[model samples]
Target chain A: MSDGAVHCVVVTPEKTELDVRCDSLILPMYDGELGVYPGRAPMVGRLGFGLLKIKSAGKEDVWFVDGGFVQVTREAVQVLTDRVMRRDQIDRTAAEADLQKALEIKPTSPEASALRDRSLAAARAKIRLSSR
Target chain B: MANIRQLDKRRKSVRNIRKITRTMELIATARFKKAMDRAAAATDYTKAITKIVQDLAKSGTDVTHPLLMPHESVKAVDMLVLTANRGLCGGYNGSVVRAALQKRAEIKEQADSGCTSVSGKRGISAFRFANVPVEKTYTEFDDQPSFDAVAKIADELISRYITGRIDRVDVAYTRFVSSSKQIPVVETLLPFSGIEVPQDDSAKGSKIRDDYEFLPSAAGILEEVVPASFRARLFKCFLDAAVSEQIARMVAMKSATENAGDLIKSLSRTFNRARQSKITQEIMEIIGGVEALG
Candidate 1:
């Protein structure tokens, strides 16, 4: 921690993506967004696909995360998910192609609809990241 | 001269074989290092997942996750045997198949029947020679096992176990103990007996437990994390098996090259001896002819 900064760690299945000391963080939650500062209450919440804003050491680092879980405690903040990519890694063209395919799903059943919806959300998240 | 020519041919063939084995040994060594790194990289993720499991266990909850409990009654089971796809790996594949067969035999009467699926052709052939019926065989895998591939297999096994189609799921693979030692062992995956974390986790586990608010609910996350952790463990098993396979290949090829060297040496010695005796016999016969004339 850089003089009272909160520790933030982003972990994925393949690797520990990042561990840094950030003054503040804004994480995506299921319904909306979550922002945490130093000395936050220990809480765990389901995550969503959106940008994670980390302000640390007088610099800003951003990452686009796929849904998983985020936990905050007095010690640090931990975000565990399957996919975490930086802004540069997002492929807008691929996401667009996936959206085109996902839109074609007729979704005749509940499961199909949910699958389509998730894919749509994922594609949209990709597009949003790429545009930024 | 004829004998010398024969020996030279044999020596040349042996030398060629030694060259090939030596190259293979070097390749296997390089591959083993890469596999070892991948296996080591996966260790942190595996350990983290284990820590999460431990925390869940300590969270003072009922811990009634579906994955944590074994299904009632011993019905049919599923066993996946992992072996090298290619041969010349010494006893690497042999040990895996042997351990799996032993386990399968031990549970013969207990379970009504079992499905034995093998990864790699070596195990499949071994089972075939033994007249053991293999339910399925996978040969697409190489030294590096893609997580998605292993995950797909693990997911299917887990789902099958959950649906009561299989009461137990066991994996027979070589566990990488160290550079010089690897042991083939059978591990129960379904009915997921708790994870084995590295030693560091045990030491740090004593830290005061954080009061974590449930995300959606603890049960919901448990539903995901439990199986995810199981998947992680299964993937790690594949990684360890890969590293072990490369090590086995390296050692096997090295010994093969050494044997070729020994064979070449002996063959040349015999050729020299044969040539010397032939020359001596010819010279003695000529001298005997001269003495007879005198």
Candidate 2:
């Protein structure tokens, strides 16, 4: 099979996520999952918290990003997220600890509870992505 | 004619003033260099974020974030006005303060015009005037900027936005364009209208087209990303303002130092001439006495 045709850059405050060409891109957005390839129409959408997977050269790269946005055009795809973490960077042990801590917290208000839930979900996502 | 004692006193006072300015110039120079380095270092992060945001904003997403929406109600507005804690740079603080005052007036006018709620009054005004509640004012951050401070400010703004305490948020600061020029700017921080793509002549004729997959949901991701993006952007702005202040101060001090040096040189020359004239007159008087005695 020909080498992966997709090329894109994933950026966050800390560093660049992925700058390599790939066959396909799977991004986590606010609405749902999005798949991208070269020569696609331009679009803008809100991003959500989840794993972004890029497949290229028979290899799959995974990144866990906070909510942001993604823009796709004919030539390149850009993913702008607040936090981008590679699979290796996601410490399963730490994530598990955070998840446990989040569960133990007794929230006093609805907003606090929702925040706790988001924290838990983030930790769970980290653990899940690392394990993969 | 001025007496010797008076001249001596005057000379001493000028000398003291000279010393003070000289010291200030040195301090300003050192601080300026440090600030410039910091400002330069911060650009890396800002540019990176800008590019990413631009790209993401350009991409099509279905989720409509709250920050993106403009609130019609003008019940309250939060203005993040950045000014140098210490004033020496020419128009830096004045320009920023002026902009803030203008904005405050505009808000008040809107309220009076029945464009907004009658009870809608300026809630908080931070900095110089201290008329409004100062959420926070930062002086020196280790000669550069502290990330912790930025994070705290960002958190406050985000919480305020999320809670609807303020209908809108804007940042007024001096955008450091060059050493001699800083433009006071007021930019909207909330409602991620869209990422602003820097103008690049090369990209003028070209277009980007690609398709992507959204994981979980686009709306969910936007909910998280928009706030984070906003916070980062604010932090970057603080860094830029700090750097600009230092640079402006440095240039201003450098010139002051040069001017002071020139004044000192001219004064010294005049003092020497005065001393010489006095000595010559005394010698001539003594010679005249000797001739008259002969």
Weakest 10 consecutive residues of candidate 2 chain A by summed lDDT = A1-10
lDDT of 2 by residue, B127-166 (tens): 3244544544554443466544665567566555555567
Put down candidate 1 lDDT per residue, B1-294, tens digits, no spaces. 777888889889999999999999999999999888777766666665555655555565455656667877888888999998999999999889999989989888788657889999899999999999998899988888876677668767765665567888889999988899899999988788765423334566556667777767776666667666777788888888899999999999999999999998999899889889989999999999999999
Tell me the TM-score of candidate 2's A chain. Answer: 0.70
What lDDT score goes with residue A39 in model 2? 60
Candidates, DockQ: 0.33, 0.18
| Candidate 1 lDDT over residue span A1-132, tens digit each | 334778998876666779988788889876678888887777777777888899877787888887667767666688876678888988899889978977986676553565467668878888987996
True contacts kept of 1: 0.42
Q: Please tell me how candidate 1 rates in CAPRI terms.
A: acceptable
True contacts kept of each: 0.42, 0.22
Model 1, chain B: what is the TM-score?
0.91
Candidate 2 residue runs with Cα over 4 Å from true position: A1-116, A119-132, B1-59, B111-135, B140-143, B197-210
Off by over 4 Å in 1: A1-6, A20-23, A45-68, A71-76, A85-132, B195-209, B285-294
